[model samples]
Target: MRAVNSHNTPGLAGLRFAFGTLTVLPVRVSRWDRDCAGAGMRWAPLAGLAVGLCAGAAGGLLLLLGAGPLLAAVASAAVPAVLTRGLHLDGLADTADGLGSGRPAEDALRIMKQSDIGPFGVLALVFVLLAQVAALYELYGRGWGYGATAAAVAGAAARLALTLAARSGVPAARPEGLGAMVAATVPARQALGIALLVTAGFAAWGTLFGGYGAPRLALAVLAGAAAAELLLRHCVRRFGGVTGDVFGGVAETAATAALIALAVGFR
Candidate 1:
């Protein structure tokens, strides 16, 4: 799957594909094939790193400007939504609605594809957003650095879940959509390797902060990934496979779980 562009390096092509599809960024994607998408999926955490950086920067600036932790937290929470055009959030809501519908697999999927959000979707969005903001608020109250790192780590961790999801053997629930384009594109070994590197990198960064920070952050990210994996399994069973909405749901689930873990840990 060496879907490189004639004018761009392989890495650049992958980054472009990652950012172009996963975000509302201005980067143009030169290729739309599965090879390109696979490369992009492998690079997803990098795209998330960018999103998290911007998110952290926004919240940190708000804190510098004298905004309270809660307000800064809200600003932090809004960045990912704005950056990703709320597609993931929408997917979370849809997945919630579909799951809550308690219908058969085919019917539940049909409900998920509907344009309007149901009560379950509304509730899920409200609670998830509240969880994210509250966790972020706790981190910000500790200090801007804590909040910023949490934001960045959570963002990367969230996409790490997606990288795992896209690895071999996960089938797409639908024949179409972004899930189908990227599903099973990554080798399981490659995905696991990336996961280890990401976790180790974040843990090393935490070590710079000294003491228990390293283990705390490492556990937080692993906890987040665990939560997302559970959701992925449930979605696979209930929906019969993965979908764009399932991807979104798992990503948000991972972020929220990480943030909460970071907020509550090492106290």
Candidate 2:
């Protein structure tokens, strides 16, 4: 579970960083410098893919065991949370509290940093989790393949948004924290390249699944990216820049948007 260090090849180091920070996996990231963070963000989709596969496998296995789609969907939704130790969800709740407060940027940031969940945070958590499970249920109803593939696509898309958000020119709201350490670390060109590659990879994944699955998946990622972009912009405007909580919020938003798009658009 030890993470690869800076001394390792760049790609391996990046993968190590991505998995180490993004998940509860045993990978131990030794380097937290900007270079490592940049590469980690670039490789974030790989971490997402791994998480998705595990989640989808859990749901798919439940379906094979004769479980109902509703139960399977709940299982699928639960895996990512368990895997990440609910870090993203917590971030989502905090970001919701911050945004819903309508306080000034400093005040809102402070609220987000608080450990307690405000009313806005609770509402946001309930609705977003509902959206995720509902969409997963629909996909599972279509068949295990649909649900599994959607899980992977949504997961990858979720991390892809993080990569995009870390591109050059994006600022961190504060001078410290994970968000600032990784902020704008990725070059714009590199981000664009990684995005295109991820999209192409997803399309390739769908080709094996048949139908218009390719476009559906590609579009799911696009939709997720677009949705994340909107949230990112709004957060930046409201909070003065991005924070770890905002990153979590964007990831969840992207994942949900991707799942919904895949559920309704392709079929």
Candidate 3:
């Protein structure tokens, strides 16, 4: 990989890096500089959008084939895991284990860095996955359009958290690894601006096509973003900064929260 500086302008290379790193897509990234990494994080939401579309299609097909919502929801939930090789789930589990340890920062970070999954990790995965499936099932029952839109919105919003995590002020938890590579790559003001733009677009989408539940769906997206921010703040305080695992945790948590909010509010 070629190393690029933060001053380098990101273009197709950044998008390719985002898709290649974040999903099971077959794109190749040639650049691996701070600028490229920041660009990758900035475009991560597009990768999530692709993942959501795939997941939505799977669920919609299952439903079209007369499968019950439960099975369809499970399939929908599984699609992103398969596409991303369960990377986000692993991060969520590690983050849970680390936080649950209640030890000092160094000790907690050590536990999180370990490959083994602890009891807290296992339980967190179980509950979070179950919640995802349940919420998706309920959303599917509403209609294919609602279910698909919810899935896609949740995915994109979840990834938007990554951009926030990579903002200029956010420090890396360690001097090495992914955190170091992408840390402080994005300006905080730029991240916030992008977030607002995305939020406005989502709101417009909801209002134009969502009918009665438009406001609710928009609120769900905001709620998901809020959840991600909370998780990011917690990780920053607990581990001294963000890590790769922290980013993953934020994605999963935000996605789950968005789906749940949609499930409850879309009716």
Candidate 4:
């Protein structure tokens, strides 16, 4: 399977081809046939949507069963990790370690690529996961509706944040890696689709939950997106562009931010 390059061809086949490369989804397509690769990045939000729904459904079921909020929170938090094979969580940890040390972006990227986890990475992961679980538990204990809304929002918004980050000027941290594939393959249309998916998902969630009356939820998503953008810009300026790790970091950070908002009062 040849990697899909933006040059030469762009089509649905190309799109499927590229997406197939990243995921183990059993899609049927010709081998590396040159064609216009449609916007594969746009599908990221869709993937998030599926993951979010699965998580939310699990949570909603738990709630309906009168299960404690703790079970719902655990299910919500674990679903994404299972769906994406823990890609974003790993990215979050790597990025935190790289960026937390106050090293240059290049050095930071290097640290991120290293296999072993450092203090910063481990700490960041623990705190972020803890925040997610605690926030969901708190929100659900008050109202499953609120927790459900946050879960749906988080499922899409995090990926949207990452898409935005990929479009930022940040270059791939490594010569050829997941980051390079994302940076190289992502297009404006794909980014726009991601945005639309996020908006639609959030709006649907709000409608279902009688509006995220909690202003904090909206603020959290926005803040997360903005933070991801700023971080991407900074990384791009410092290192010429973002990598797969950076993009994943953006998603994880956005999810964490949204959860935090859910935990705090938004009224």
Candidate 5:
């Protein structure tokens, strides 16, 4: 179905409708593109919500299928890769090439658009993905319950990281592109939705594991936030701000790190 942005509803479906536009619509949505452009990045987190929940569900199913830790881990990672057609990965590659060149920002951005993959980009993608897989396997090895909790946190937190990356100070690669538009338009309130959803996920998982007794769950999430902040700081220092690729790479990396940390320390 075509995405229709409405001024009428503020319920869940209304939020979902806004999300549908960001995901399904390939070309960047603009006020020019749609009569409903004023919302800006208000809908960016909704996009994150859509992707995170879907990936989390896939992780949930992997746990349900009696899958092994390694297999389950791979499946959880694959959900976003397939769903977003590796858009974030593409960003990672491009951003790596641009940043590694050590040229002007405009030159770096130009490098990002080139069809050929540079060595820096290739190495960055491979190393990052491997790190992620290793982290997920470690989390799953802790226990199915812990693994599930990790997945839910990873799924939600990664998106929250992405939203935050978009909102933070980051010069776009171009004057008006997807990265710029999203950074410009995504509102802080919509970003809060991701935080709420993630908190609820943790709360539910905590309850399932124990009563309010699962205090470690809160700590795990706090670790995720800390990791996200660190990654953002690194990106800002290295790249001078986030690009679309940098945002995706950092999100994926932070989620992986958080899950692994949770697995290792939540004893």
Candidate 6:
């Protein structure tokens, strides 16, 4: 594995690394070492924060222009895809294909590493994207503030999964690639702290924007986190450990669950 760059400053390098790797934003990263990678993962939620803001803004603009909830929802859902160049969606598809194959672990990992999308992948992408759009539409119909908050919180919460997946006990599925490089780099305690911080932020968001009580927001976040943890365990069991695609799948799944929970609560 590549060592951390000695010259680049940690915070700025991490910020640039996070945006550069996670989104299609034109960020120039000066380092590409393991330390920088871990820092980038630690700061992944911040990248999600920016992506969420942009998505919320797009939906809010459409609403301001008198667009219907469905169109606004579509636009909001499309924003993250465009920003990330559909990387997360691709990961979701690949992961689904791998897990759905019902083959041996080696075969499944081989399938996931392939460039082509399979039938299971296509179906997974279609249904998950539809679910997101539908959930956002319901939230949007209630109020723009609630919809925007839900979008933002979901994005942040989704990216927060990366931090959890990178904790000390987690291992990489293989000896190479992004997953192997960053695997087990994050301290477990730091991951737990970050998770708590994110859950707290979600509660604040719900209270300030969704008019949700603290308990409701906490429950929603807990639900999302539980779903993510389950996905992590499944990936570890099936693939021998987490892969980069597993990280993507966990993020998308968590985000969808959180958004759905928030929509139901608001309704």
Reference-based TM-score, model 4? 0.80
- Winner by TM-score between candidate 4 and candidate 1: 1
- Model 2 vs. true fold: TM: 0.96
lDDT of 5 by residue, 6-67 (tens): 44334433344445443544433323321133243334444654565665566567777887
Give each model a TM-score.
Answer: 0.96, 0.96, 0.94, 0.80, 0.73, 0.94
Whole-model lDDT values for every prediction: 0.91, 0.91, 0.86, 0.69, 0.61, 0.85
lDDT string, candidate 6, 158-215, tens digits: 8888888888999999998888877887889988898898888767755664345565
For residues 9-67, could you state the per-residue lDDT of candidate 1 as single tens digits? 66677779989988899999977878888888899988888898899999999999999
Per-candidate clash tally:
0, 0, 0, 15, 4, 0
Poorest 10 consecutive residues of model 3 by lDDT?
4-13
Ranking of models by lDDT: 2, 1, 3, 6, 4, 5
Q: After superposition, how far is residue 236 of candidate 2 from its true place, in Å?
A: 0.6
Q: What value of lDDT does candidate 1 attain over all alpha carbons?
A: 0.91
- In model 4, what is the error at residue 88, expressed in angstroms? 0.8
Rate residue 103 of model 3 by lDDT: 93
- Write candidate 4's Cα lDDT for 1-267 as tens digits: 989643434455544654464334565444442122224455555556566777888898998998999999999998888777788888878877877878887787788888888898899889889988998898888877767767776776777775676553435667787666666455566565667556655554454445455345556667667766766666666656777777777888888777777678532
lDDT of 2 by residue, 1-267 (tens): 988545566777778899999999999786678888999999998999899999999999998999999999998899999988898899999999999999999999999999999999899899988998999999999989889988898889899989999999999999999999989999999988988999999999889878887988899999999999999999999999999999999999999999999879756
Cα deviation of 210 in candidate 5 (Å)? 3.1
